[model samples]
Target chain A: MTTPTQQRLSLIDVVNRCDSFPYPSDPRLERLSFLTFIVDEIPCGRIHSSVVPHIVAFNQQDRPVFHITETTISFMPWLADYDSRSDAIAQMLNIWRKAPKSFPSLSGWRDELYGVYTLNTSPLTTKGGAALAIERSACGIFGVHAYGVHMNGYVRTGPRPHEVKMWVARRSATKPTYPGMLDNMVAGGMGFGHSPGYTVLKESMEEATIPIEIARNAVPVGTISYTKLSKDETDSQPETQIVYDLELPADFTPTPCDSEVENFRLWSMDQVLDSIRSGEFKPNCACVCLHFMIRHAVLTPENEPDYLEIAQRLNRRLEFPGCKKWPTFKEEQ
Target chain B: MTTPTQQRLSLIDVVNRCDSFPYPSDPRLERLSFLTFIVDEIPCGRIHSSVVPHIVAFNQQDRPVFHITETTISFMPWLADYDSRSDAIAQMLNIWRKAPKSFPSLSGWRDELYGVYTLNTSPLTTKGGAALAIERSACGIFGVHAYGVHMNGYVRTGPRPHEVKMWVARRSATKPTYPGMLDNMVAGGMGFGHSPGYTVLKESMEEATIPIEIARNAVPVGTISYTKLSKDETDSQPETQIVYDLELPADFTPTPCDSEVENFRLWSMDQVLDSIRSGEFKPNCACVCLHFMIRHAVLTPENEPDYLEIAQRLNRRLEFPGCKKWPTFKEEQ
Candidate 1:
């Protein structure tokens, strides 16, 4: 294994891995294009060309679920309401779940539902409901924007502000996604009914065995967003991670309480940077670390040549819609 | 004037004021397009359609400086090196400076130089050289990317992280640009020969009576970028501001030392937010305050509905090239 001081990947390289979609500067960016996936007149997702034939076949059923055109794949006008669209999509996804060989992404089917929202509608807040809800695992295949919360737990080690150490979690080898990869101290998908702060508190206890009092101290900092396009162009996932920072006491240590994490380790900022440069952390989680570093002044304009580019890439604007209003979250005593 | 609480602008509204360019979602975005300004075969700026006639007239001189095509306006191939291009552009600008009526932007020319740089070359760090240096006031007319440094000085009042106050500055009434506007505690353009850190320190002392020891403690955070396109489409300015945060002692107060600032006042977060919602702060300075609030957890996901959008807008991706590397600086005793 290479030492921590060995040649390191530039910060931009790590960001590019997460935000893998072609930039405007890239040549031939049009070669890997997808059709817009519209639901209830809102552009909610994208559909890869390879998946069009399967959708076309599904449309040939006694009742067509989708209306396909050259440029877009939209829900049938008859499926107007949220419940009808979600049920129809769930029924279709279940069919694919059974034939896992044909739809590889459905092999790890998660029954947990994720809200498909527009700028005006949110399952958690809006009086008008989301466009639809789909199984969490199927979100990437549909190219829908997914939301999550990730918290960086750290401790100030010395008198100076930059002297700090971070709590890092390694994913359990048996986990379905990103098995054995490094992650932030606590992270979880924003399930259909949960607020971001609620998710953070819940994940903190479930994943890190933190007490409610300590976990409630997590502060919502900002967000890091990216659109990850799979190499085969079969998956288009535009995701946003609502980031938080929890400054733990120097004596406090995290213990894993769930199968999601294999173990927890506290490392200095240098160790974390080396791990990030070595691609040990999951791409999005690495981005979260970079976000924390940038905000806390670990990486400055003088030290990181790609400082500005990294900042912009960490917040790539998605064409699809997000919730117009976020739900207010309060800790349950 | 309307009170801060009376029909206040949303956070997204404040962000839109700074980044007022056409997003991909805008339908009529093509109408306000400008041709790319290429220097040494690199896209460094833009040229408004109305200004093409002026360049064409200059090209008619005995020794043409520009080669204008349908899509782009580029410097002549003969002007290869940095000196030749800077001298030639300076000569042309001098001619326009004499006829201030025709070139209205040059009317307030300060005789200060600003570097025109590409990704590979910076006036401060690159050994090769910058593309050229032009008059600071005329950068907007040519649509070049300008750089600056903005510092947010704050004091922590309570044990809690969000319980902090910010130092705000009011621009002098006699200033040329945005006269009497509200600004951050300290801000200045990235002049030709200065580094961002150096600019921050210099401006800290020159604008506000900050000692070198205190200014050196300013921590470099991330950056904020935006493309401000004028309503008439005559000016296209893409700017990047390197952000800094300084934690001031509760006892210290800043007094305006120069004519650039009228005075400095420390305000509570509530007052600052009210001013921001009322559009009382200068556009870019408002963004800086928003960024500071975000990092310090003053504005959170639950409280700010437009949190995600605001974060993305604060770091809008600019197409023009920026410095590939920044210079390192040490505080002088």
Candidate 2:
């Protein structure tokens, strides 16, 4: 109601509200069969698009058995019903590659394979856990916008609430997606064949030159999830980021050891928030940063009018799934 | 929608929808000027009843300045605008006490003083930093229902990753409050003249035998806010709990160190949740326990259909004020 200095512009708003896009309202998308993506016997996601033809063509290969109904497509309860879940996913990927117009390109650093299942469900606990597949993080934009884990590693000065600083990274200009955007000190996807813990450790070493000893100490503070609808409207991204905070000593400096990052800078909290407000950081990373800020009490419910909404929306209840209570993930074949 | 077994509860049907009292349609209460309770010039609550005569009487007593209007009553911005903020609050309390029928007894254990402010704002930062007052928590049920903070501490045994245990307490039967109601392992109101951090420490020592070393490691995970209308329809309670989780070792036993708690038991997570679902735990404590369950990954967003709704409702935005930008609270005389 008042002239807005920063009512809804907080990092949590831009990234979190993408879920507000109404998929249920799109008749064309709805007319398409809703294939529920399942894990641990729970339906985590659904194919909201008209991908029946693709499913049919891919099924012709004598792989991936699915229940074909007028209103839905469901993977059979048995993962062995298909030769291999990953192989079937690969076939779909092959189809997308053949017709670039249908599915967009896997962009930038996200070209690397990432995990796309409900976090850490297994055959011992789930009927079809063995059948889940993996894909490049970018492909999830068009494919199933699977719930993925994201970790942020930061450093502080001294103990006793000394001056606080955050380790921030700048994406390489050569990166195809979000190139040269501001990022957390260290961030990474829960790639296929990796637990959130493993991914954090791996990313700590690769993304920033953080030692295993320090990265292991990173506390899993909380998680933030959002359903992002990209500007081009080509894909819908439903993701859940498992957030972490690793406090470092006064002398700790994060050096970029991976090409994904152009450089790393230790910036004050004010500087980080300022950049976030100015839209310098990638949307999701900014949200990840804000998650840290709120948890750290740097951003209190008193200071931000949208604090309640931001906090609620930060973990928007997806009609989909999240990895909590999920069993430990199985090894990738 | 399906018969039973907790699906997404319609807002009207929430197990905890406490606003069932028909206040909006009640002309007597509606006709009240709805005096606003403001801190640091931010409106936090309103006197729901038509208490104009009482306000006028309190102001006549050579103390507490007030702005009386046909539509609202407001605190003077400066104590010089009155005698003193505490004096004004005391006068209001005095008026309520004298008219025993007008305002009921200060029931339960909340005769204790609590800080009611806009959070930690500074004199240089706020318009009325020095004009805030302390009040009895029980009185808040009728007065402003000021937002309060509650903390939860839990423990997990190392032997069985399959099993998780939470320390829960039973209030003494002889207590004035909801005696014998199951409470959090450590729960306390943010009293006047106390910071949340400082209060957590004080309550930890008094309620549980947790060593400071282990208690200091407690994490301020997040907060849960709710508005409850007493079943008897006498009062409306709006509260916000800043949740904490202090994990204890496998062998740690919580000894009730004070007479406030008659007993302490290390409850299994299932037992804790079952008690909550059955409403055996104090409503606020039950809600607090649920907050911990959701965070510890024991209650995944997947298994619980109401995960999103529960999460959102846990921090329902109050129509009144929240402690935002409040300077560190000044002590009461």
Candidate 3:
């Protein structure tokens, strides 16, 4: 009889897969080529060099939305306010959405809007300084900052990290992005007008069929950030994932309530590590697992060679402004 | 009845106190002036501009230890090997130690050596690449990366973040640095020849009188790094503190076993936060507490405005080299 083989991965390798960009301290970054996405004279995002011509094409439109320079693509000075800019961008995206072959990034057309705030403004606080809100799918194309909530739902068999088991979800094969990939039990984008707390509660119930009473216990932990340069080099995704931890009763099992998740499984720490090593987990989802392990002490300085670097890289400080406060649903109304 | 007023601080305020340096991504950093400390042509540390005159005085010696330039100070070509470099630096430091009036940083004279390594090497891996070792007290003067372990000893009253209470230590009034300030229950320097695991266990007992069996349960969670510029502009402290979390039995109480600490007390999360706000805790120690809060979900994305920034700042990636793998005691013997 043959024994089963186990796959292994270095902790740094797992982190590098998610945070693929060179470190900000690296000298090579000074020579890298990318165009700036400017709004109100503030450099807010990194637009891919390949996407410059497409943006320049928008400037030729009857009502030009953007003013294009050699190294920067900025909103026209006339479109100063939030609603005007949002409407102009949305109109442009809708036109691009019509031609799926030309603009592949707008294919999903997530109808949901993601707010782009300046460093001085947060969604949950003052509303005036918000630069614009655009379709969630277009966030990557423009290299704007995006936000989401990822929660590790787990059951504790003992007090130690080794004894803890996590509830992992498998995305439905029919889903648009990262289909059939492993993911956190409860995960959702922080769409405009919703807080991380609200997103956690909403996603937990919709995706996992978890009761609100049980999901209310989901505690907001910290965040994991990365600027993932798409494999094709056409998209730059600078994202912040607000992480949470929910300890569920061992007796209660999670069942897929929506088409988003294919199934859920209670996995041991070893199984999680093995799956991560084998590349069965989504890059960001794997990063979320690494964050969980670091907090739970399953991965420590003794066992992990890149403990400090991993911790720092997991929460990379993005140059573009992000929402310091997540607007609650009640506040939005 | 009138209630006692409680001191309060924003989480960003606590993190800013430790990571006071301009971020590496900040444009203003390019204009900041400092000289790089070069070891065997590898940029290893930062030297305060004020200390350049003193380093120049050393070059006037019959056998100069360093080759100085306007922007950088490099070790002399004659001192090519580890032993030669270590001895030459030590000799100069000893002379400086005699006249503490001029070289105030050498006054502590702890006699513990800190190894300086290139980015390509670690103390636990190849031993030959260690450029030199110098007294710990003078590490800040040279701006070399120093290491330490800080463990938070706490008791879990419940599963929630606020349900835990920490064992806080008050440093002795007679202590040279941050005298009478609040600190973690157990903390100690990661000397030249010790791993973080060994340091945590050793410090737990020496500082808090914790038993070996109990101390061994301290789980290494993560690390907090900062580049602390001295108030007088005389020293640059780029240090990394390996952080651990120890959940003690509810009945167990920590007692001061060494003269470093005057007393220990179990403090509520509120009390700890208040103390940190009141400036009763050392800057780095307060950062460790914030790290605990972030991990335990006390300070979350919902509650802290600077949640992402604080998390990133707490683990600032040092430009200089640090030991990736710490040397075990067995290896040293």
Q: Pick the candidate with the highest DockQ.
A: 1
The stretch of ten residues in a row with the least summed lDDT in candidate 2 chain B is: B17-26
DockQ-better candidate, 2 vs 3: 3
lDDT of 1 by residue, A185-285 (tens): 99999988678888999999999999999999899888999999886767989999999999999889899997789999999999999889988899999
Model 1 regions more than 4 Å off? A1-7, A122-129, A330-333, B1-7, B122-129, B330-333
Worst 10 residues of 2 chain A by lDDT: A324-333
Give a tens-digit lDDT track for model 3, residues A139-258. 988889888999999999997765799999999999988899899998999888788888888899999999999999988777889888776666778888989999888899998998
Q: Considering summed lDDT, which 10 consecutive residues are worst modelled in model 3 chain B?
A: B120-129
Tens digit per residue, CA lDDT, model 2, A1-333: 223464436554565444444444245444333455554454545554456677776767554566566645666556532235555666566666666565555422244554444444555533233235556644444345454445555565543222468888899998777899888877776655455666777788998888998887675545666666655544566776766667777677788897999998888788888878767788878887776676665665445555545665566545543333332434422
Which prediction has the highest TM-score against the true structure? 1
Ranking by DockQ: 1, 3, 2
Q: After superposition, how far is residue A169 of candidate 2 from its true place, in Å?
A: 1.0
Score chain A of model 3 by TM-score against the reference chain A: 0.92
| RMSD of model 2 against the true structure | 10.7
Ranking by TM-score: 1, 3, 2
lDDT of 2 by residue, B263-304 (tens): 988878877766666556677777776666655556544355
Clashing pairs in 3: none
